[model samples]
Target: MRFGMGQQRITRAECAHVAALARLELTDEELDRFTGQLDELLDHVAEVEALDLEALPPTMHALPIANLLRPDTPGEVLDRDEVLAQAPFAEDGQFRVPPVLGEAP
Candidate 1:
């Protein structure tokens, strides 16, 4: 099977081969469904390739973008003792979090 001029259609055998390579065990119904879906995707790609895109400028994004973050500048640091006082569990001037690796605190 072929799509658009010379774009070879994705075959069930090829799809099965790819699935085997990826260690997948696909059923006949899945192969058929995926082959049809991949063929449709390839057809769309071929259609895009057939377009004359030389006149259009390439873009990384479809719409214009700008950084919305505030400018990074030195800010007042929170007092360590004050912040630690608010924690439910604070020890040795730092927040005390539960052990993660099953190690004793």
Candidate 2:
């Protein structure tokens, strides 16, 4: 399944060759199915490459947008005693979460 800028050759024989290399024994029906899927995928890629995207600037988002956010500011926090009192489990000055590894308690 070699794909690059040049061209895409996703024939049944090619798919079969790749499958054999991977020690996979695919049935003829599966090979044909994968070959057609690969060809369709390559055709889509070719279509995308044929588009005139050069006129447009590269952008992470498709639309013009900005993060509408408030400025970070210092604020009052929950009291330690009050917060700890609501915890299902707590030890000393921290919440007692279950063990991350080993057998479950």
Candidate 3:
């Protein structure tokens, strides 16, 4: 089996186990894909382990971030009729979208 150093080739059995734990139902193809994806992810983690950070003092953070400014003032808005005119199907001053929630029969 082709393998990356320190990376365990995730097996179908492990995929199935994980799918069960996650309450996911996967077909054989999906299981195989998940195994490969997990193996690649572990390989990346193994590479990260090789990083050298011994010289630098443990800095808890890189930079502090402040809240971005946003304006609360009302700005010019699109006219409802103008906006609704662009839709292929609009109902009563609103854009019509495909029903996701069940509609009354």
Candidate 4:
């Protein structure tokens, strides 16, 4: 699903049509580029169409992973009063910031 699905050999004319639909005016170099690209893409599609999918189990995740955990521990807290003392504007127990906007018209 992430890659190729259907099988179809791409042609230069189809590349031209796609370029026209995308509003692209391709030069000879660009047209050749797109032609090769489309051909390769279709070749990939043909490859995917040849897959044998009779035994693979479909799953939500690719593989299982585990994590080791440790118990929570309290740590030393910052001195709020000391921090606020260095603030440009501090009121009551919290640091005050400037208003973003003036009164609306």
- Model-by-model lDDT, in order? 0.85, 0.81, 0.81, 0.78
Cα lDDT over the full model 2: 0.81
Per candidate, the number of residue pairs that clash is: 0, 0, 0, 0
Q: Write the per-residue lDDT of candidate 3 for residues 50-73, one digit (tens) a residue.
A: 789799687656876566788689
Candidate 4 lDDT over residue span 1-105, tens digit each = 234444336667888999999999999889988898887877776677689967988776788656657668988988999999999889989988867675332
The residue pairs found clashing in candidate 3 are none
Candidate 4 Cα deviation (angstroms), residue 103:
9.2
Q: Please report, as a residue range, the 10-residue window in candidate 1 with the lowest summed lDDT.
A: 1-10
Report the Cα lDDT for residue 15, model 4: 89
TM-score of each: 0.67, 0.59, 0.49, 0.61
Tens digits of per-residue lDDT for model 1, 22-96: 999999999999888887888888788789999999999999999989999999999999999999889988899
**Model 2: how far residue 54 lies from native, Å:** 2.2
Residue 80: error of model 3 in Å? Answer: 28
Instruction: Choose 1 or 3, whichever is better by TM-score.
Output: 1
Each model's Cα RMSD? 3.9, 5.7, 8.9, 5.8
